[model samples]
Target: MSRGTDPYVAGAMDRRIALAHEWDELVERVRRLGPRFASFLAPPRTQDFLSAVGDGTAVLINVARECHALLVTASGVTAVPLPGLSAAEIADRTERHLTALRRTDLAAQRVHHTQQRARVRKVPATYQAHHAAKIEMAEAQAELDRTLLPQLAWLWDTVAEPVLRALGSPARAGAEAGHRIWWCPTGLLSFLPLHAAGYHDGSGRTVLDRAVSSCVPTLRALARAARAPETEPAETDKLLVVAVQEADGMSPLPQVDEELRLLEDMFGPDRLTVLEGPNATREAVLGQLPQHRWAHFSCHGRQDPLAPSTGGLLLTDGVLGIKELGARAYNGDFAFLSACMTAAGGLSLSDEAITVGAALHYSGFRHVVAALWSIDADTATALTGDVFGSLTRGGRFRPQASAAAVTEAVIRLRNDSPAHPSRWAAFTHIGP
Candidate 1:
């Protein structure tokens, strides 16, 4: 009964050898089909394909209760496991943070209203009530901090630190200047701010500190975008700048004019097509989209939680829903959605990839810069101007330089307004 020539073991080994050969043949066929077609085929879970992507970038895919950090470099890929980080927990924390943020915004508004009332002529009877309300708001905020800080710390420990460690701690001393990461989060994790996840333990351990963070819906999307054709130079490229300062019943954004003016100056008047107020209608903007290589939207954006695909940019006539964009094929390469919730997704349908930014990507824009929440008008203008300026300096346009340029611009804004995450962290680059 010696096992030296066991028939069962020998047969199993032969089958495995044959399967290996079959797999190699399949892979070779996919390679000949091209990157776009090969993307549809599931890649092997091993590190063999990492060489096909860019250097110094890692792609983290979060799923269910764990994260798979695929460290991609010019040489190879390495998978790092991040366990015990459940999607449910991430979602709960995100919702809690958003609630706290809304409460903080309301408190600020109340304080401003009280100040306006005081300026007019405060009544003695109402003064005591207003002061009491302010105190109550402060106490509520303190309570919220007690709940929020711990969750953020947990995320840093469980999620961000592991990913950074896998990427060889790009934040460490003497690391190269342009380290980048593309986060492809699942479920509610997509809505959470992965870039800002860190504890406030006096140690700068945040993702923003470590690397420039960008997002893509899938690894396939990132690969596709990386291979997309380059846009024409700014001098020759056509840009469609749409600003809906007043759209029906929505609040007007007068600062959009400033954003448009800055963009016009950079792109030059002949290269720019300006659409504002009544002219920035749904049909008009959609019609003009195919003719331009770039588009900048400075208007209100809405997210429909009930039907996520219905969410879109609010134009003068109506909403330019994702459904409409899906029907068209445009030649645009970049889209800057300077609007509220352009990157936000419905909690229930978080995996649908239906945000305005995603829609623009589907509509053939290789790169999209969008907001995760409502942004301050002045902050948006400043950030956009700096980003585009960095891109077009020396009269040369470099689309490949966008990620680093955006990170630099946001860091500058963060330095100026350190306490306000709403101003800096809200905007995110959503593609290559």
Candidate 2:
């Protein structure tokens, strides 16, 4: 019976059990240390967070009743009130917007299969379903515009503008061109696009108008990322680019090929290890993660509302769940997720920051770029290419400068596609 069993498998199982016991012992020891040591184990203090901002940057923490804006400049930190926006209102609007987006996506799928469905036996049912979906999408679009725009304007007036004023309004000194602000919204506000909040009446008053926007899961996360040691760009610095365009039971992302080709050109084929199509398995990607300084995934992302921690990037073999991700220790600089809804935290786990972006942050990546909602393939490709281009300009990869690089890249996309907030607003930087 011992000879029949695989020795390697048995050895791995033994190691896992030993590790589990060690982890349990460590946890018990920590518990015995009591509440005095708990603060040390917890997130950093407000002063530590203020130091992380490092001039010309602010951090916004949105809670249930109201939002707190911490304007951190070279001098000190100033806490300001973001009035007229509550958690309940944010939750309502988020649900409405997400529902509208889902309807629109279903309509798009129906439209794509219209010609194929026309040839099927149940033509009438297919046609009726498609037509009904189209009508639903139109109504949802109208409703979204009617309800969401006003809320965005209100957010701009109440939250963003106040934060801007507290920071001395970077727009006045032409500082908006270079200044950055990191938004750290809690609860339901995580689903809303605080970066795109603006008065849509052609007033040119928006968050983007004042400063480039980025996001962080927490101020403590930002502080930790800022303290990450900078490494010089070398030939040994490898990038792992995973593209799952043809996964089973999923629509093919034909544009991902072009995206990968573009990335290869920017990062050089010698430095990038491309795991694409059938080879982009969960085990393959996870095994290679520790070897690379940067990783980019162009695939589908599923956010499990009921079990947010179980949600992950959809690879060829299976989902690369956040729980699996948190088990790894990495020293990577960034993880750029060119997938849909990578930053959409479930309502129940809203304050917990249980999303792919946050997972990457916790997994030891200094910076993470992920989407707040589903993004079109073409737009994602363009945005990602521009981001990499900005980061690697003049044949140098500056990981420490990712915040500005990501912000500027998104700003460029917003300028080119001014009418479509969905295109430019979905992708956001989630750390320093």
Against the hidden reference, what TM-scores do the models get? 0.78, 0.83
How high a TM-score does candidate 1 get?
A: 0.78
lDDT of 2 at 199: 65
Looking at candidate 1, the ten consecutive residues that score lowest on lDDT are 170-179
Q: What is the C-alpha RMSD of each candidate to the true structure, in Å?
A: 8.5, 9.6
**Roughly what TM-score does model 2 have, to 2 decimal places?**
0.83
lDDT of 2 by residue, 1-432 (tens): 287889899999899999999987786688679775655444467776767777657566656455677666547777788676676677787778777667666665665566346557466887786677667656655665565577678778768888777766655322236457888887778787887777644455777666767788877788888778787765438889999996655567767898899888988878899999899998999899998889999998878655788788999998988888878988889889999878888878788888998998888988888998767788888888888887888897776677666666766776785656667777788776
Number of the top lDDT candidate: 2
Shift of residue 148 alpha carbon in model 1, Å: 7.1
| Candidate 1, superposed: residue stretches over 4 Å from native | 1-52, 65-67, 72-77, 101-153, 172-178, 199-202, 231-236
* Model 2 ranges with Cα > 4 A deviation: 1-43, 62-67, 72-74, 108-148, 172-178, 200-202, 234-236
Best model per TM-score: 2
- Candidate 1 displacement at residue 78 in angstroms: 2.9
